[model samples]
Target: MSSAAPQAPDAAPDQDVRRIDDRSPWWGRLRAAVGRSRADLAVVLLFLAAAGWLTHGLWPDPGSRTMALNPADQVLYEWFLAVDARALLGDFGLLTDRLNAPDGVNLMANTTVIALGVLLAPVTLTLGAPVTFALLAGANLAGTAVAWYLLFTRPLGARRLAAGLGAALCGFGPGMVSQTNSHLHMTAQWLVPVIVWLVVRMLRAADPGRGGPDRLRLLSSAVGLAAAVSAQVFVGEEVLFLTFVTLLVMAVTYAVVDRDLARRALPAFTGGMVVAAGLALLVVGWPLWFQFLGPQGVATGLFSPHYFSADLRSWWTLSPLSVVGGDDAARLTTGPAEYNTFLGWPLLLVTVGCALWLGRRPLVVACLVSALAMGALSLGPRLVVDGQHTGVPGPFALLADVPVVDGALPMRFALVVLPLAATLVVLAVDRASASTGRARRLVPAVVGAALLPLFPAPLPTSGRPPVPEFITGGYWRQCVPPGGVLVPVPPATPRDPWPMRWATATDVAFGMPEGFFIGPHGRNGAATIGTSKQPTSALLAEVATWGLRPAVGEEQRRQAERDADFWDASCVALTVDTPYADSLRGTLEDLYGPSTRIADAWIWRV
Candidate 1:
């Protein structure tokens, strides 16, 4: 059992009550939010330092730089720019024709990072999206860690040192670093703690034996929880979904293990959850409707569950994200930055060992069971052992066909298990390190040896070329009217949203033909992205792809005019020396006469 005294559910820990942040009024909470404490400031500094080191390529300047080979990062940059444009324009619609042109896309279905977009609007406006991206990338990991640290210390009854250990594991662990590859939604998990904290408080207040829930107080707490969940929907619906699954698993397991306590908790738990869900639905109903039923919405089952499921050996391996590992160690499980659960043998053993050792403790049991359940679900229907698919089905079979849940990647279920492992490991480390016996002296050495192999490397980044003078120096602005379409020669594809670099840097004053984003593919609303090819554009794309020019005849000429009109193209700009640039220029010249010289390119007004 945990070496802590149990208290009434409604009672605050004496230590927590002593803290001014908890006891003081709104001003004190505001101070805490602003991170007034020395420890909090230290965490911020640490995070800033980490961000600087990780995104060094984007340092000292961003408008003139980019991160190469990170399509996800690139997509997020567009989102920042898009959100900024929409907010400033007073547009409430999440759908846009800026990319995927005529088809447009429902931004709600994409990783729009709405919460981050709104929260960091000031920074984005002043500094640009790349800097915002870089800062948020680092802050997400650090902030999540700090949030977990606070929760562990205050509510979970862990020591400050123990909380730090857990926070470090939760913040910069392999799972988090892997997500930093490009997934902002998964990375920006700071609100998860806030939601969890609120839920715990509500649950405590709901305990009937502790004078029961005061109707007004319980309703208010329910509202708070609802707001948190609603906020999460805009932030990361997948993470929100995963949170629900994690809590449900924990609750179910707890009920199974402790029947009497389960009975006592059942009514309050259900009521609180019901109220929270209802209120959350009210807040997100319209967006949810647009996401599912509006134009460009996609169907479930974006990818095969089994294909994306975890390899059994992945849990015991290391990834390139690990500081101590080489390419060989990294290759043992999947490619770089995709290792969802490369827990490594040492950490896995330590986590399981701790869970077994602490099985008697209710809190420990809950954490362990939740982690194990998520791990099982991550493995998908078919077991893959050492990259070989075994014919056996797995635990995820139960959820494989379930609506929005089915849209989630089975492998990403490991995210829910991540914090549980961190919590368990920290608890074990705290008990061992804080002991008075001789074991205390050896604890550091043993723990270091086990954890050293899993230490995360600084995030890997690459340099990209800066925005072209055409856009930055305002040449494109001269050619295209505000909000007019400036179709690039080789527009943009779903896979290569390269033009977005210019689009975003130009502050999204104009739209492009097609850019990187997901939208409806066919009559059935299949999820697809990238450019849809028509005749003239198709010919141009083929030329870009193969360096071969097709015959541009009368039909193609008419098609080109139609395409330009369709895109509402104010000017057709061709960047010199881009793939098949010569052919594209010749074709456009045939259709619309010689192009006028522009900065770094030629433009023909539509």
Candidate 2:
């Protein structure tokens, strides 16, 4: 009977098939929860608010009564105003024009980070210049947050307290705070770490086992590398150094981990190089090629050292703590390093120890190698003899010889080192935390303790002099009253022994009649002098130069004259503790008749 019923062909044995899906809704929820916790949303929010308040409070209102109080802020204000003008005219072409403009290229020529302000063009249109500057400041803050997350989360392995401290260290780092007013480009330097993290992610994805490294991933890495390099070029050398160090670290790490992985990394590495080359061609290569390629190229002397020596001591002590307590205390005592310095020196020591302990870990080993490489680069031999023999300069000399970077004085590449330092500090803290229990608690406690002395105190407002009114008026006055032009006059300085300053003033004055001066003493003023032989005419030479359609305005000539007078009078009139101001006073009297003072600024008629 059992055979007849046929047992339904043995009825398969009721195999209770249970399907399990690896992906679950709770998985996403879990990830989100973890990310939120690691980030410390509340603390981040608080820091953001504080940053916003400080930015808003310190920023001068466009056309308001407040004047630019510091050299750094002054430069940013002028640069913003210039950008605002170009934006108002809807002249995207000015991208080129501004780049070539005497002041535009002069201030930003060597340092490309000034271009980051271009992102503010839309913001400027929507909210006005004040808001744009505010946004710019906010972007710096956002960059810090991104940098913190990037440094602490993955490579440092996300510990909330360590991450928070690392972020705070970056936000309040000495170089960051010291140049807060002047180093807008350095502020943009924060982007480098983010880019590094992206590259690392792409590299990790391409780790051979994961589908053997996709071409797309390689392409993306290349694109990202190009973008990072381009951004550094825009920001100038400091950021450039950071980018270089970061890439070098990654490259070395890849090399050490697995020779095969290093080989595989070639495509991505080359792709990045190609991208960077393309961008360089677009920005400086084409123009330089055209300008210097022919017979005239030799005359330009692109290889010449057009600037003076920068102080080495200043670069090393850019931090407030270093300035105050380090050996070079006397030289750095004057700046505002009071509030924004890192307090975790002992923690930093512990971090170093932990890093040494974790030296075998791939990421840590890579970072350590990177740090050593960067240090060697920054502090390596000059190789003057080698440079002369080779005709081609070494990388360090070439970097120092670059225009904007050359003018950075002692801190020529400090922008580059700051991130490395920050990363080391973060990594160190992370390592300590990961070690045995005692070390973890000790690291944070030591850091907190060191930071105690530098805790921010209420900055005094009473002694804070009112920012000049003209600086306010020129920056704010939306429309350059039809006939008026903004003319920038170079401020008189002991370093500027020649009448070259006058030429710069004349060049800026030649453009528009609104009579708004932006020069050495005005907005966008800096320590270096413009050296372009045809500074005044450069903007008119090429449509691509100012990113504007080529057109001439009749009013431009008359405006130039008015601007010249303003430059001759105001900038020259503002005397200093230097002899150059006295020479400028005499030069102004010869060029334009004696003029009465307008607020703190003097007005002269040619």
Candidate 3:
């Protein structure tokens, strides 16, 4: 029949086949990669949904959603938005006059999260600060989970569902959930796995047993690692520091357990680290200098490590972020920033058991020591469970004097456990699914049960009163001249924080005398902010705190004038909703004569 052979029309006489190769233009390959990323878009969407669901109360009205446990976190977010506004105006001062007024704060010294602030600038500029905070918070959880998921599935060769389990456990587990209540800086852990992935790529390329990578591949990996570390510095330097400590410990553990593999991987890993550190220093050298050696910065931790060390009982306690957590969950925490450090009995047992059972495996051995070491440190300088403090000090006390490491909280070291736990759990789940006979049924059931109580509940939120109309509606702009200060009458305190609110609402158009920021406090260069208790400020703070109008004498009047002159404040305004607003206004009137009413506040032009 005619169909004995089907032959395609031969290439045209002059035509030649062109093979697909690296010859494709850079942008063309970039576009192709972008298209492939759409496959991961699902992971992003799923994570975003999960994060949003957990903190859903923040949505619908992002402006009003507040962090009840950590008011300082909200204050920091407002500062981030203010920074974004300044950046939009073409003013990129790393040291801001908006906070400490005449004196300023080195942004590098704080957890400013410069990269996140810049990246989310548009969202903050448009919807306002609180909304930007909520979005970032959600993104932090989701993005972190997705990053781990990609690493497990793409390079580590884990199954899809298994990878997802790993991702969820890392992203939304109790530790992460607790941090979500506040602490945007610590929550930004998405980059850790990315660094690991890049390091792995370099290690594979450098493996002598196989054909090692070319110079170009090694260089590329090195550069990539450098970029990731630099970005991580902006997100959370403490986390980055912890990452470094954890990696070193894990590497040592691996060397002890599997010397040959360590021998193969260590040189390449060390070379890559050198490259990354050198590049990071080059990019951020000046800022780092200011942070460590300049006027505002402190070389060591601002507080003693003992103050931030975790209580041992915190390991078994439930976090407020958990569905089963009670109202007292907040009481158990060291502060607003460390709530989710809880490691439930079941989850802890499974993770430790898996680490023990899978000891011979390279992945398990490396992760096991990382978790154990960090966990021990989280127990703090001395072991404290429930309420009693034990005389036995923990491992972290050794690092308390180690330069920058001293400044970081020991409790946060617990973050190392979640990812390791996730990896172990995923391996178990995947192995069970792939196994034969009775093994398959039992393992999955066990894995599911271990994670049951760890499931998160929606994050609790409170209402944040909106900024007054005087600043938001732009009336304050008319009052304060260029470079002049706008000092709120009650000044700034942790509770009310009016000056900070007004300054943020006005987009830092005017300087502020005091704000809710960390800055030089006493002779020690100790970190503190908000209104200092000067004679005049103390009088105002007293009335505000006690809701009582104290007698204002000529001394108080003279003191007010002196403060305004020193601050160079062009105008002094008072918000109606400020704590004991009326009383403070009455006291101000007694001191500064009759004040002009403007919008929802009283203003006095200096």
Candidate 4:
């Protein structure tokens, strides 16, 4: 009877308990992990879809469609990709003569982006540069958003919804969208967050009370930071320079705001930064040398600081890329691709209000200080409001003459404000959500109102001029030898880059005497685009532009022959449908003696 009772009561209960407990530890933990992964996956997919929507203008037909506002920059990037693709196939050189012919161009001196090109060489060589460019543009936007989202959620402890919102602002904000119009160097910022995270880790490791300074952690973080910085240099040195400025401002602000924490963190922070700088030098030193002092290098700055400076009114204006207040704000910006800070007045007002509300947080204070400092610097030497010069000098004037700083477009300083603004918004929302009724509701409502007007619109695009049949159909092989020049009717100058498109279309099969690229001009090596003008090219350009055939004489014909010999010309080809084709053809016929109508071009064998 006792055995029967024990079996009935304990046996069934023990079996049930074992079954439940055995599954709970492993199965429950696995379920939680899968749920977390699924949430992360959902966020990534959402960001990617948003990126696609933002870049919808280019994906339909990248070969034909071009950024309507900045076709020049788009065409320039395509040429860069083509050069990089060719460079990967054992034709690699920091200085390439493919564009400027025998004089050559210093690739390291320009934003050639060889690292990104090599990574995408397969796509570029297979589907062509146009497709690779479009793919990369979308990937940059999505990848940046995803990276920032991870930083906000995992390290900063922001809620998922708040993090998503903030990351969207960082990735698709007015400045980011404006630069995304073919400025791959600025938009490829996914690595920035990783570097920021590593720095934060170093700071934490420096705190003596937290198990007394972790040397190993500090060293690892420093090495990681160095790797990230070196990679960033290859991606975009301008952005990296701006990032350093922002970080310096933030560190100083933090030190002032929280003396105790700063004292604890500074020792490790400074040490880690020193280590990172040393390591980064080891990696990028040679490339830097090649960029600044190598053959064809320009000694002077490329752009004017004052002209490209952001207008003070631009701070309160809306970006033309935004959904609201777009049409009225065009006059406030330099160009469609340079709308760096059209952070409407409403958003600025809200940000200031939130900063005041979250005044106790040290990180919040640092972000506010950094943003304001960067904003002030973005106004350049003299402040301009609504296209009127205010005659008041800006903070940037103090550093304008400094070597590396001189090259920066002062307006781009506004880009540093974007991530800072995003961080402030996320911290505000996350904190407010933890508070009671009225405060939470008011904060969110105001933020939503401010952000709705700044939502991004699809970018504008137009059809690109098609490549000539002679180049695409491979008929140039019959007239021009493998390593010889094919002098286009008017040549490829900065004003008319159409022939650059033709040269790249052939995968750089033939060199050109003239092209749209920066080259050393004078004894001091001041930067100039395209080669020095020759008599033959000048005459041809004049004829093509005004449809007026010049008076052909023996002297002009002799100059043309000398130019052809100088260029090592194998043939001279003029597209049948080029503008003022008859005038150009007459001039070419007079110079070269006769022309053969082959394929879709008038070919004259030199």
- For each candidate in turn, give its C-alpha RMSD to the true structure in angstroms: 4.0, 13.4, 8.4, 8.8
Locate the minimum summed-lDDT window of 10 residues in model 2.
1-10
- Candidate closest to the true structure, highest TM-score: 4
The regions of model 4 sitting more than 4 angstroms off are: 1-26
Per-residue lDDT value at 290 in model 4: 80
Give per-residue CA lDDT, model 4, range 185-227, as digits (tens): 8988898898888877887777675664789998998899999
Candidate 1 lDDT over 478-585, as tens digits, reads: 789877888887777766567777777666778887667766774576776554676667777777787766776787778889988887888888888587788777
Model 4, clash count?
Answer: 0
lDDT of 3: 0.73
Task: Tell me how many clashing residue pairs each candidate has.
Answer: 2, 35, 1, 0
What stretches of model 3 exceed 4 Å from their correct place?
1-41, 327-330, 529-531
Across 149-216, the per-residue lDDT of candidate 2 in tens digits comes to 64565443555555666676566555455445534656655666656665665565455554645667
Candidate 4 minimal-lDDT segment of 10 residues: 1-10
Best by lDDT: 4
CA lDDT, candidate 2, residue 526: 34
lDDT of 2 at 481: 30
Q: Give the candidate order by descending TM-score.
A: 4, 1, 3, 2
TM-score of 1: 0.91
Estimate every model's Cα lDDT from 0 to 1. Answer: 0.72, 0.43, 0.73, 0.82
